[model samples]
Target: MTTKNLLVELFVEELPPKALKKLGDAFAGTLADQLKALGLAGADSVVTAYASPRRLAAHVTHVWLKAADKAVQQKLMPVTVGLDASGNATPALLKKLQALGADVSNPAAAVAALKRAPDGKAEALFYDSLVTGATLDTGLQKALEEAIAKLPIPKVMSYQLETDCELPGWSSVNFVRPAHGLVALHGSTVVPVKALGLTAGNSTQGHRFEAKVAKVVIKDADSYAATLQQDGAVIASFAERRAEIARQLAAAAAQVGNGVRPIEDDALLDEVTALVERPNVLVCEFEKQFLDVPQECLILTMKANQKYFPLLDATGKLTHQFLVVSNISPSDASAVIGGNERVVRPRLADAKFFFDQDRKKTLESRVEGLGKVVYHNKLGTQGERVERVRAIARAIAQQLGGEALAKAADTAARLAKTDLLTDMVGEFPELQGIMGGYYARHDGLGDEVANAIEDHYKPRFAGDDLPRNNVGLVVALADKLETLVGMFGIGNLPTGDKDPFALRRHALGVIRMLAEKDLPLDLNALLAGAVPAFGDKINDATPALAEFIYDRLAGSLREQGYSAQEVEAVLALQPQRLGDVTKRLAAVRAFAALPEAAALAAANKRISNILKKAGDVDAHVSDVLLKEQAEKDLYAALKSVVPQANAQFEAGDYTASLQTLAALRAPVDAFFDDVMVNAEELDLRLNRQGLLKSLHDAMNRVADLSRLAA
Candidate 1:
C-alpha cells in the first residue's frame, strides 16, 4: 500500500515543432490514465507534462507502488445444472470448480463453498475470490507502452538499434523519432523498464549546445524539473519556456523604445517554443525600404518562413526590427542577431520584387491568366468560377442595393480571383485575396472596389469579421454561396468531418451574414438564386443547402446559450428570413415562461395530433354548428383575440403576438375537456376539427408551440 511520486522521460531527436505540444500532452495524459485504470494511481493524482525539442517527460504524484487487492464474485452456472437432487456436485460442477482453481478434492466441501444467487427465474452458483493487485513495475510498463502507442505523432521514423543480446544483429524500430534514452523513476529508485530498445535510467541529454553537463541527472521525481533547468541549461516545461520567451521579448522591445511590440500570434509562439529548449530573445532589423511592400507580406514571411515575431508600432504598422527566439544565449549575441538579419533580407527582397513585378500588369490584365489556372477538375477553370461569382454578386447586389451597388459588386467579383495569378500569391497562397485588394487600388479602381475585392473573403474562419461595406458584404455572400451551391450540387457535401472544400465554413459564413447583418433576403431564395449561376454544372440543391445552413445556425445558437428546446421550437417553423430567427426565438422563450404556457403547449400538441388524423379540415366554423357551450366560448375567444394577435404579428412584435394569443388557453382547455373533436355526428366532428385547426394556426405563427410541450 506504499505510494510514491513517479517520473518518466523519453529522449529522442527533435520532434515536429507543430505537433510537440500535442504529443507531450497525449503522452503524459495517456500514461496517467492507464495507471489510474489499472488502479495504480488514485482519482485525485496530479500529472504534469514537460516537452522540449528533444524530450517528452511526465511527473505524476500520489502513484501507488501496488494497487490494492479487490474482491471479485464470478457467476459459475445455474444451480440446477451444477448440483444433483441428492445435494452432491455433478461432473460439470467439479469441472467448473477445477477451472476456477477452487478446492475440488472433496465434492461436498466445494459445493458447500459455492453461494446460490437468483439470476432471473433461475438460481446460479457464484464463486468469490481475492484478486491480486498489479505491482508498479508491471503497471508502469503497461502504462509507458500505452502512452507511446497513443502519442499523436505527426509522422513515424524507422531506424535500427543493435540487439542487447549476444547476437550482434540489428532490429528495426518505428517511433516518432530515433529515441536514444528513457528514464523512469518511482521516487528516487530507477524502475527497470524498457522501451524502443532502450532501458530506463536516471540520465538524459539536454540542450544541444548550452547544457552545462553532457547529461542531466534527474535526482528524484520532485526535483526533475529543477535539476534539468540548473544542470542542463534547458527549460523542461513548454509553458514555462514560452512564458520566458514572451517576457524576454517584451523586455527587449522596451529597450528599443518607440512604443513597439511584437506581433501577437499564438500559433507562431507555440511553434517557436517547440523548436528550442532554452529561449533567448534578440532584436534584429531589416532595411526600411522593404516596408514598401505590404506589411502583411513582410509579417507573413517573418512568422511563417523565418519563425520570427515581427514588431509593430502603436498604430499596428510593421516596424523594421523583428524579434528572434534563439536557443543558445551567447554573451556577445551580435553574430546571431546579424546572421538572422542577413538571412531575412533576401526573403524580403523576393517579396518586394514580386510585389513590384505584379503591379506592372494590373489586375485587369491578369484576369485572362486565371482562365488557364484550373480551379476544380469538375468545375472548370478559375475563369468560369469568376463568371459565376460575378453573376451571383450582381444579383445579390441588385436585391440589397440598386444599379450603382450592382456595378461595384460586379467589378469587385471579377477582379477578386485575379490575384490567384499573381507571382506574390503564387509564392504565398495565403495572400490571395489580400494581394487582390492592393492591386485593385494600384489599377486606379476606387477604394470602394479595392476594399470590396479584399473584404469579399471576410470571415474566412470562425469569429472572423464580416465585410466592411455593402458591396463587400454582397460579394462575400455571393462568393460563399457560389462555393456552397456548386459543391452541394455536385454531391460534394461535407460528410462527417471530411469537408475538403470547407462547405461547412462557407455555410456558416452565409448564415452569419444573413443573421448578423439582418439582411432583408430570404435564405431559401438566396440558395435557389445561387443555383442558376452554376447552370447545368450543378443540380438544384437549395433544400439540402438550406437545411445545412439552418443546422449550423442551430448549433451556433445553442453554443450561444439558447436551450435545445427553445431553438427547436423556433427553427421548426423554418423561418425563411434568417434575420428574424433571433426575434422568433426571443418570442418563443417569452411565451414559454408564461404560467399558462405548459397547458397551451400541451393543448396545441393535442390539436395538431387531432387535425393530422382528421386529414384536410378547413379552419371554418358555423355559429349554429357550435352546439356545445365550451365550443361557443372558444369561438368567441378566438374572434376576440385573433385580430389583436394578427395586428401585432404584422407590426413585427412577435413577443406581443404570442402573449395576446395566450388569452385562448382557458377556453381551449375547456373545449378539449367538454367536447370530443371526433364526434359521432359528421357535421359536429368536422366543425370541431375546424375550430381546433383555427386555434392551431394562430398559436404557431411565430414558432411551433407544440415543440415547447414538455
Candidate 2:
C-alpha cells in the first residue's frame, strides 16, 4: 500500500488574537470529525495544527491516503424516459443515452420504482455522485478552506486592494495584520490542487523577528512541526503548548524562590501563551505603598491588563512582587521592567485615589449611587436590581435555615454592587465583588455581611471556589436569582450560542452553590421566591425559569463529565431541589457501576412490560384474585422487600436502596418463571399487574430503573 502525506495551511491576514488562538484547536478537531464521518480511518490520519496572528495550518500525514470507495445511490422517477426531439440531454435521460451511443445502462432506476427498497433505492436521479477517487490532497485542501470559512471570526474583512469582495484575491489582500499566503505540501512536495483557487506550496513564513519565509519540505505532520519550530515559532499542539507553559512557569517560579509561585488562573495562562512565541521570564516589583489599594484592583491590573503573574509571599497574602513574561528576549531587562512599572504606576495611583475616596463613606451611604447605573435596559436600574436582590436574599436566607444568616444575606445583597459606583471599582471592573466586600468591611459591616459581598460571586467561572459561609451562599443565591428571574421574565433568553446575560452561568453557579455545598433548600421554591421580588417585572417566571435553570444544570453537569440525559432523567424525577437532584445523580452514577445493577434495570423493564400488559394495578392482590403460584410469590416477595427499600430511601442511602431492590431480582425471576397470570380469569391478571406496579414503585424511589441501560 503506497501511502501519502498532505499539508493544509491557510495563510491569511493576521487573524484577531482571540480568533487565532481558538481557530487552531477548533479547525483540527472539526476537520478530524468530518474526515472520520466521511468513512476515513482517523487513526492513520496524523493531524498537527499550528496558528499565529497571520496563518493557520494543519498537517495531515498518511491520512488514509484515499477516501473509502463507494457506489453513490440515487432515486429516479418512472415517467421521465426520453430526451427532447433536439438531441439535447432530456429531463428523462433515455433518449439522450441512446443518442450518446449508450445502452440501457442503468436498469436500477426503473427497477427501484417498481420494487421495495433494499438500499433505500437502487436508482439514478442525476447519476449518483460517485467516489471516483479519494484524492487525499484534494479533499484535505478543500476541507481546510471550508473550515476557515465556517470559523466565527469576531471582526472579519475582505482585503481586496480596491475591489469589495468578502473572499479577497490573493494578489492584494490583508487580514487583521496581513494575509501572506497558505502552504499545503503533500510529502516533501507542494500539494497540487486548486479548489478555492489556492495552490499548495512548499513554502511557509515564520515569526517576523529572526524568522523569514522559507521553503519547508516535510515528510509527515511531526516533521512539519519540527521544521516550523527550527525555522521559528512554536507549533501549538494543545498538549505541547500546555506542557511548555507549565515548564516555563515552573522554571521561572523556581528561579525566584522556593516559596513563591504564579497565582492560579488557567484562562489567562492560555492567552499569554498565544501572545508570545518564546517566553522569557522576568520578576518585577511594585512599591509596597500601592498594596494599600484594594488587592483586588492591584491584582486585576496586573493579570487582566498586563498579563503579569502576581507571586505569593510566604505568608499567603498578595505581596509587592509580580512575575511577567515578555515575548522577546531584551538585552536590557531592567528597561523592560521600568516600562511596565511606568504603565501600572498611574493606574495604581488612580486605584489608590478611588480606594481613599470610597473608604471615606460607609457602604450604606454609597448605596444611593447605584440608582445612576443601569443593570440592563429591560431589567431596570442597578438600584432596582439591589431591591430585588435584597428581597430575594431575605427569603433565601429563611429557606437556608435561619434569621441571622437571612439578615446578613439581605444586607450584603443590598450593598454588593455598591463598588460599581466606586471610582476604584469603575477603573478596575474585575474588582467589583472583592472591592464591595472590602469597603463593606471598612465601613464597619459585620464580617458575615461584609464577607457575603465577595463570596456571592464565588466560582466566577466553572470550577471557581464556592462560598464556604452560609451568609455568602444566601447573598450569592439572591444575586443569581435576580438576574435569572429578570432575564427570563423579559424573554431575553440565550439562543444559538448567544447568552448576553450569562443566565446559564448564573444557573450553574447557583446549582454548584446549592448542591456542592449541600445547602438546605428547595431551588424551585427559591426561584419562585425570587420572582415575587422582581414583582410585576416578571411574567410567567416559575416554569420558564425552572426550565432555564435545568438547561444550565444539564450543560454544567455535562461539562463536568456527566451525560446530559442522565442529568435530565434525575431532574425529571425531582426538580424541586438542586442539591438533592445532584445527590440523586451521583447516586444513579454510583448505582450504574454495580455488577447486579444492570440485571436490576433489565428486571425493572420486565416489570414495566408486565404491568403495561395488565393495566390498572394499583390495588392489593387479594388471595382470592391470585390464581397463580407465581403471582402469590411475587406479592409475598415485594411485601417483605418494599419496607426495607423505603427505609434506606428515606435515609438517602441510595446505594443500599439499589442493593435492597436488586435482592428482589431472584423472586422476580422466579415469579416470571412460574406465573401465567394472564389467564382467562381477569381478576388474576389484574392481581399480577398490581404486584409488578408495587415493585416498580419501590425501586423508582431511588431512580427510574426502567430507563437504566442494562
Candidate 3:
C-alpha cells in the first residue's frame, strides 16, 4: 500500500551529445520495465530521466516500498497455429509442429520433438504443460540488462579495471561515458547493483573541481532526489534546465533596455547546458565597430565562434552588446567579459577579410577554382557538378516556368557553387550557397540568379524551410540527385547509421521540396533525365536508378503515415508530380476516415474473395450473357460510373472519383447477395465472373479499394 520514489544518477566523464539523449532514454525505459516485470509499477506512473554531457539520471516515481507479489510462469504459451497438409494431430500436433518449422513430410520426426519426460510419465504436451513457479524480480533484472546492452551509444567505452578499460572492440561493456556507476534503487532501498558493480547511495558530488563532496541521507525515494539538490548538484532535468535558461535569458535581455534577444538555437543551448553547472547570464559589450560588419556575419561570429548570444535591437538590427553564460559566479565580471571579447576578435577579423577579398572578384571569375575542390573521388570536381546541374536544372525548370526564367535558372545553376571557392565561404563552410547569393547580387547579377544560388540547399533538415522560388527548387533537387546517384555509383550508400554522405536527408529534402513546391515534373522521368549527366560511365541504367529513387521516396512517404499499399496505389499510376501523388494519397487517407470508405473497402474485399481465385481480373466483361436482374443492374452501374470517375480524375478531384466508383458498391452487393456466380449454366457463371472483373478495374481508378483499410 505504501510507495516511495527511486533515484539513479550516473556520474561519469562528459558524454557525447550524439548519444546522451539515447542513453538517458535507455536508462529510464530499462529501469521502468525492470520494475514493472517485478510487479512494482504504479498505475499510469512515468519514469523521468535526463542527461548532461557529464551525467545521466533516472527517477522512478510512485514505486512500491516492496515489490508486489507476482505469479510467474516459466512455461511459454503454445497453441494450435497450423496443420500438416494431411489433417491430424497426426504424430505431432499438426498445427503447432508446422509453425515450428518441423518436417511435415516426416510426421514421425515432428512427433519426436514433443516433450517426453525423463520419468516416461509425460503428463501433457509443451503447450498444455506448466512449470509450478518462478521468481519475478530476478528475471526482470536479467531482461533489463539484456535490453540496455543493445541500446546504441555510438562512442562506446569499457569500464573494468584494466583501469583504462577503453578498447577499440569488445573487451568489456561499452557505454557513452566510462559508465562510471549505475545506481539502482528500489523504493528507499538499493536495488541489486552487482550487474554494474554499483550501489544506490545517499552521497553525491558537485561541479567536480569547484565544489567539495556533499553528503545527505535519504529517508525515502522522494528525499533521495531532493537530497541530491540539497547537496549542490542541479540534478539536470532537461525540461527544468530549458525553462530556467529561457527565464534567465528573457530577464537578462530585458535589462539591456532598448532591444535584446536570445539566439534561436536549441542545439547550442544543449551544448551550453553541458558546458555549465549553474548557468548565469552575463551581459557584455564588444566594440561597436564590429557591428559595421554585415549583421549576418556578426551574429554567426558571436554565436558559433564564441557561444555568446547576440543582442538584437527591437527592429532586429544587430547591437554591439552580447550575452555570455558562465558556469561560475566571480566578482571580476568585466575581466570575464574581456576574456570572451579577446577570443571572438580573430573570428571577426576572419569574416572581415573574407568579405573584403570576395567583393573584388565577380561571381563569374570564381568558377575556375571550383575544379580544384573535388565533388567526389570519382565524380570529377565541383565545376563538373555545376555543368551537370545546368543541364538538369534546364529540363526541370521547364516544368516551373516559361523559356526566359528557365534559361535564367540554368544560368544561375551554372554559377551557384562558385562561392565555395571564395574566402568567406572557405572559413565559414555553413555559408556556402549563402555567400554565392550575396556575392552574385553585389556583383550586379540579377535577383533570380542570386536566389537560385542560395536556395540550392533549402530544407537542409527535416523541419527546416523549403526554397521559396522555382529556380531554387530546380537547383536544390539537381544537387541532391547528383549526390544520391553519385553515391550509389561509388557504393557509399547509407547502412547501419553509417550515412556519412547524408544521403537520407538529401532524399527527404528532395521529396519534401517536390511535394511542397508544387512542381509538375514526372519524378521517374527526372531521375532518368539526370542519371546520364552523371560521371562519364554508367554503372547502373537510368531505369534502375529511377527505381532506387522510388524506394527512397516510398520510405520517406511511409514515415509520414502512408501505408505501403497507399504508396503503391499512388505510385502505380506513375504520378506526373509529387504534389499530385500526395494529393491522391491524401484523398485516400481522408476517404479512409469515412465510414463509407470502410464500407467500400469491405465490399471490395467481398469482390476480391469471389474473384481472386481466377488468374486475372483484367478480363473483358460480356454484356450479352447477363441472366439475373442484379447482374444487369451491377454491370450498368459500373459502365455508367467509368466516365464520371475519369472526369473526376481529369480534374484531380480524387474524392469525387472515389465517390463515383463507390456507386457500384450497392449493385455489387446486390449481385453477390442474390446471384450465384458459379450457376448451373456455364454461360451465366462466366458472365457473373466478368461482371466482378469490371468492378475491380473501375474502383482501381481511384485507388485499389481492395488495398484500403476496412
Compared with the true structure, model 2 gives a TM-score of: 0.77
Q: List, residue by residue over 516-589, the lDDT tens digit for candidate 1.
A: 99999998888898888887888898898888888999999999999999999999989988989999999999
Error of model 2, residue 131, in angstroms: 8.3
Q: What lDDT does the true structure give each of the candidates? A: 0.92, 0.70, 0.70
> lDDT tens string, model 2, 72-157?
64433322332235523354565543443435556444333232233344432333434555566666655665675666567655
The predicted structure with the larger TM-score, 1 or 2, is 1
Model 3 C-alpha lDDT per residue in residues 115-229, reported as the tens digit of each score: 5332343234442222232232454355456545756777566765343345644345555556455555556566654345444454455555444354444445566445555
Residue 546 lDDT (model 1): 84
- Positional deviation of 430 in candidate 3, in angstroms? 2.1
Tell me each candidate's RMSD, in Å, in order. 1.3, 6.2, 8.4
Clashing pairs in 1: none
Q: What TM-score fits each model?
A: 0.98, 0.77, 0.77
C-alpha RMSD of candidate 3:
8.4
